[model samples]
Target chain A: MELHDKIRILADAAKYDVSCSSSGSNRENKNGGIGNASFYGICHSWSDDGRCISLLKILFTNVCIYDCSYCVNRCSNDIERALFTPDELADLTINFYRRNYIEGLFLSSAVYKSPDYTMELLIRTVKKLREDYNFNGYIHLKAIPGADINLIRLAGLYADRMSVNIELPSEKSLKLLAPQKTKESIIKPMSFIHSKLLEKSESKKLMRHTDKFVPAGQTTQLIIGATPESDRTILKLSENLYKYYDLKRVYYSAYIPVFNGNNLLGVSSPPLLREHRLYQADWLLRYYNFKADELLTEEELNFDVLLDPKINWAMKNLNLFPVEVNTADYNMLLRVPGIGLRTAKRIVKARKAANLNYDSLKKLGVVLKRAKYFITCNGKYYGGCEIETNKIKNKLLPKSNVLEGQLSIFDSIYKTESNLPILV
Target chain B: MVNYIFDGTFDGLMTVIYVSYYNRQIPNDILSENSYQKNFLGDDIYISTDINKSDKVQNAITTKISKEALKNIYYVYLSELESSYMLIYKYVRLGFKIGRKINYFLQNDIVNDVIKLSQRINHEAYKMIELIRFKEIKKGLFYAKIHPDYNVLPLIVPHFAERFQDQYFVIHDVKRNLSAVYDKKSWIITDIPPEITLITKEEEDFENLWKIYYKSISIEERKNLRLQRQHMPKKYWDMLTEKQ
Candidate 1:
């Protein structure tokens, strides 16, 4: 096949993974290296589907031996397959990186010959990029499940970030949809990467010039709405992944049905709103210091479609409402419905100079429409009505379609308004 | 009332501060020569650029207030807003009064405006770092063109120079008619022609491949042009290869 045809096929197959972040690595350029990684990631372009194209996201090859029903590259599917030579892939990465088309490469693959063989191919490709080309840009590698622990370790040394996708949320879903894969196969490599990352950090404290091993850390993805797992279950699993594995990010890809055959549930469209809510709750868990239980309960299996996860939580716990912004602790400020991390920090810092009134809160970038229902600036309540749950819920609920102005999935996941454009 | 007119350089602005402070005159407004309007009411004083006076003012700001305050002042000056000059004058004067605590006074309109303008410049500079795309012009020479809202060419070139130290590249800010050229050893910002188009056959081939890859990567199931435009605004679309 032609090179362009191969890229089209491989990139299309790889788009479903949805882990395009090029962040969390600070790899410096060597004396003669071609590129360097920034502390925070840079997005090169946004795709037509509103996703940031940060890396050259593509599969080394689309050929697979496993017959996972939900995947487009399943063995049973009669799809065109292409494999890239190690040198060909590395050359493409260098050419693209030089032309500033991408930050680096995000190489994943289906189980082509064997897990170990495929993993070896990935290692050779990155090795060629790093050693032959002296490329020090960001690289995100996918650790093939069931690959040898030693091989995974070697790949981690080359990659800035490595991920092992836990596609299904539960073991039961994995067995039903991807019969060939086992839970142990996925978790073992993740646990191995986690420990290696910890060891790297510990050794770096003792000595400054240790070889970097996955310096950007690891992230995983879970396919949502495919296997009847509720939002509560998905969030709980993510919280555990963060707490136990010390993972940097857990991506939730709303399941898009690739095969319309038996066993897999049929959906007309991707569960994007549910995915958006899950991401919102994920942000609360990661940055806002809210536990999964605090965001949802056993009785509430799914997020309310009308309101965001944070507003929902705030309405439920009305006793915490009307907290004085002037005197509220930083943690309490974060818990307010409309107060984001940047605004909360700004309030904390600004209040040290003088008391902040409602007008000043607006200038600090607080979303007053929602925060008024929860916070009081200087002992004066601005929430016109009483702090009743239903009244606040009615005010906060979306007047239009909830999905009309929804944020792009990746952009809204983090509270950093670093990407927001300034209006001239 | 006196209106201070400067030569539109950071040094000139600093000299304006120096002259105004030594003369003990509170100007009605501070304007760059390019943006100054003749008003019959206020006396307009054209302040020439003086390195010695500017250095003293800069040193005083660094010693009395903070280095961060000086950075904020520079960024606000780069913003080129008509009010930015006066805003910085008030901000620096206030910074001298409260030491480093001036930045924390977000409620004060002058300090708040200065911070916001500086943040805007920083934001645009960061965006340029992300959105600038280079095309291989000749075998080893790469070129990119951008028209950012703020004068962010100087702010963003250091990043590219560091990342592509061994390669030859030019980043042109078309709106300002300036280009930063790096020739494998060092980089310099200089004037460029208003129109320059240089492309190679190989560059076109790679651009086509990138356009193809960009299209293939977007999920058809979730296509939100609004969100795409929100993140990557339409004003920047002309320079983006894939968008074109």
Candidate 2:
């Protein structure tokens, strides 16, 4: 096949694996290297789907031996197939990096011949990019499940970040939809990378110069709504991943029904809003110090479609409302729906100088539309209405069908602030 | 009422702050020569750019206040907003009085305005870092053209210079008619002709491939042009290779 045709096929096949971040790596350029990784990732462009195009995200090949029912690249599906030569992929990455078109390569592939063989191909491509081309840009490699431990270790040395897609949320879903993949196969590699990263850090502390092994750490993706896994279950799993495996991020991809199979959910559209809620919940878990159980309970299996996860949590715990912005701790300020990390920090800093009021909070970038309901400045409430749970819920709900429109990937204010470098 | 006019340089602005400080006279407004309007009521004082005075002011800011404050002041200057000069003046004066605590005085209108303007400039600079796309102009020379709302050429050049160390590239800010030229080792901001076209044959091939890659990567099932426009604003679409 032609090169353009190969790129089209492979890139289209890879778009389903939605781990597009290029941040958290600070790989410096070597003396004669062609590129370097930014500690805070740079987005080269935004795709028509509203996702940030940070890396040259493409599969090394679209040929798969596994027959995952939900995947577009299932062996049963009769789609175009293409494989890139190691040199071809490396040259493309270097050229694209030179033009400032991408941060680096995000090389993922289907299980072509075998897990180990496919893993070897990925290693060779990154090896050529790093050794031959002397490229020091950020690389995110997909660690093929059930690949050799040694091979995975070697790949981690070159990749800034590596991931093994959990594929589905539940073990039953994996068995039903992707019979070829097992829970053990995915978790084993993830655990191995986690251990190796721990060892790398330990060595770096003792020795001044230790070979970087996944310097940006590992991340994983879970396919949401494909199985009967509730938002609570998904978030709980993410919490465990962050705790146990020390994963940098757990990406939730809304299932886009590509193949008509009885095993998959027959959804008309991707569960984007649910995925969005999961991200918000994830942010709260990571930055806002909220636990998964705190965000959702066993009674409420799913997030409220009308409100954000934070707002929903706030409404449930309305007894905690009207936290004094001037006297509230930083953590309390963060719980307010519209008070983001930046704004919360700003409030904490600004309040030290003077007692804050509603007007000052607005100038400090606090989204007063929502925060007014939860905060009191100088012992005065500005929510206009009494803090009744149902009334507040009715008031806070979207006035229009705003959720019908496709949501921007970075719609969450916290997500954008997290992307910015932490202010000094 | 008196208006202070400077030569529109960062140093000149600093000098205006210095002159106002020593004289202990608050100007009704501070304006760059380009932005200055003749008002019958206010007397105009042209403050010439002085290196010594500006350096003294800069040193004082760095020493008395935090380095973070100086950085904010510089970013606010780069914004070139009409009120940026007065905002900086008020901010610096407050910084001198409160030391490093000026940043925490977010309730103060002058401090708040200065911080917001600086953040705006920094945001644009970071956006430029993301949106810059270079095309191979010559055999080994790459060129990119941008028209950012703020003067972010200086802020973004260091990033490209560090990332693409071995490659020669020029990022031209078309609105300002300035280019940041990097030649393997170092980079410098220089003036460039407004209408310089340097597209090579190979550059066209790569551009086509990139456009194809961009198109293929977007899932047709999740097409969201509204969200796309929100993230990558329509104003920047003209210079983007894929959009073109």
Candidate 3:
């Protein structure tokens, strides 16, 4: 295939990986680098999926040797095959960067004849971008499982971040849906990168002076609703990964059934709402300082469809309500229903100025519709007279019909935020 | 009545506001950049460019409104809205009467109008962090020239400083002949030299990668330029890396 043709195929193949953050790296341009990466910042664009296109995510090649039943670019699937030489991909990356089209490259690939060859192409493309093209911008490369350990390590040096898709939650699901892949092949490289990050972290002064390994760290995606694992199981796996692997992100992709596997659990799309709820829960885990047990039990396959993860937690723990925002510790403030990180920080800042009043609390953009049930204003309860959990559920239900009527067949979808109804 | 005219800067606005607050009978009109002779058929007029007097006026208003409040009024003036020039005068006058409770003006429509203009400038400044992709030029100087919808040159420095810590760079807002320069240690608001031409950007190494990434990530099945244009209008494209 021509270079452009290869770019087309590989890029389309790699679109399914959605980890796009390029912030929190201290990489800089030097004698011959083409771009630099920054901390606390990342460039973003919108995909057709409305997903933020922060990185120029693509693949080095889409021609695979292994047949993963869930993937569209699997070897068994009859699709156009292509591959790009490292130099060609590098040149394209530089061109795009110059035009301000993207922050950096997100290079991934199918097996492409062999696992080692695919890893080599991915590594070479990043090296050409770093050494030959002098590009210093962010580059996120996918570590191909079953590739040589040395190759994965080299790839890490050239890329700012890396990800290996866990794809499914359990070994049984993997065996049933993708017989060619194994649990060890995926986890082994991830464990290696995690330890390497730790080693680099230990020699922090030297790594600080020199360019570090994957300053944006690593991420991985899990396909939701593809296996029978409950939300509890998924959250437990995520908790372990965070505790052990120190993964930067764990993306949940809803299964969109383009093809059927004999062992696939669902035929229709995994509820996108379920995916959204998972993100909310993930946010609670990462930012709101909540545990998986606080939000869900082993029996529940999903969170309450009507409420957000934080609000649901607040509903479950009504005893924690009417907590004084003025005296609440940072973690407790973080758990308040209407308060987000920004609001929490703002409260901390505003409280130092003077004792915040109920009026002032509302002015800080606190969503009283839900927060009233969780907080007291000037030591006075405003959640409601009874404040029953079931009553609060009906009262606290946000206006869901926001974009539902807004997305009529003839209406413009982009003009609205959502297609669901808000039943307050 | 004497005119307290000063150079076109925040100091100049401050001087005028300070002088106007001390008295209520001074009828004045402003002439800036281009002055044309009009038929002064029925009215008597006084022309003044007393920069020192303007400075005196600014000092007094700073005392009356507090330095922070006065500084905010000056930022509103920089927004360059025609009403902004008058709004600053009225709000400052109101501030002098209201004392330290000048924040009440934030609710008044006239004050809110100027706030909107200031918000536009601030928004442009924020977008600069996201949209202003830099290209390294000769001598390790990183530069990016932007043509933004609002004059946001003054507000982008702090964000870039926190983000790109060790780098030295210049963000030029071509529309207003203004730029922000950060030299690793500190940032300064300055202007581009008149002798130098604005550098024309070409398809550099990173641009190729970015364009390919853009084309590759855009699924042909779900290409929606209308939605894209709605979120990011074409006018904002010149400064945008991908659109450019």
lDDT of 3: 0.68
lDDT of 2 by residue, A1-424 (tens): 8889999899998888888888889899988678888877778887877777889999999899988888888898888899999989999998888887899999999988999999999999999999988999999999999899999999998999999999888999899988989999999999999988888788888999988888998999988888898999999999999999999999888887766655455676677767777877888898889999998998999987667788889988999888988899999988888888778888889888888877888898777777888988899999989998887777766454323211222342212211211111
* Per-residue error (Å), model 2, residue A169: 1.1
Model 3 chain A lowest lDDT segment of ten: A410-419
Q: How close is candidate 1 to the true structure, as a TM-score?
A: 0.96
TM-score of model 2 vs. true structure: 0.95
Flag clash pairs in model 2. Answer: none
The runs of at least 3 residues in candidate 3 whose Cα sits more than 4 Å from the true structure, single-residue gaps closed, are A205-211, A260-263, A299-301, A401-424, B1-7, B10-78, B81-122, B132-147, B154-244
**Whose lDDT is greatest here?**
1
The reply for model 1, stretches above 4 Å from the true place, is: A401-424, B37-41, B192-198
User: Model 1, range B135-243, lDDT digits (tens) per residue?
Assistant: 8877888889999888988888888888997798899988888889888788888895533457878889888988989999998767767767877888988888887
TM-score (C-alpha) between model 3 and the true structure: 0.76
Please tell me the TM-score of chain A for candidate 2: 0.94
Docking quality tier of candidate 2? medium
lDDT of residue A395 for candidate 2: 73
Kindly state the number of residue pairs that clash in model 1: 0
DockQ of candidate 3 is 0.21
Once fitted onto the true fold, the runs of candidate 2 whose alpha carbons sit more than 4 angstroms away are: A261-263, A398-424, B35-42, B192-198
lDDT of residue B229 for candidate 1: 82
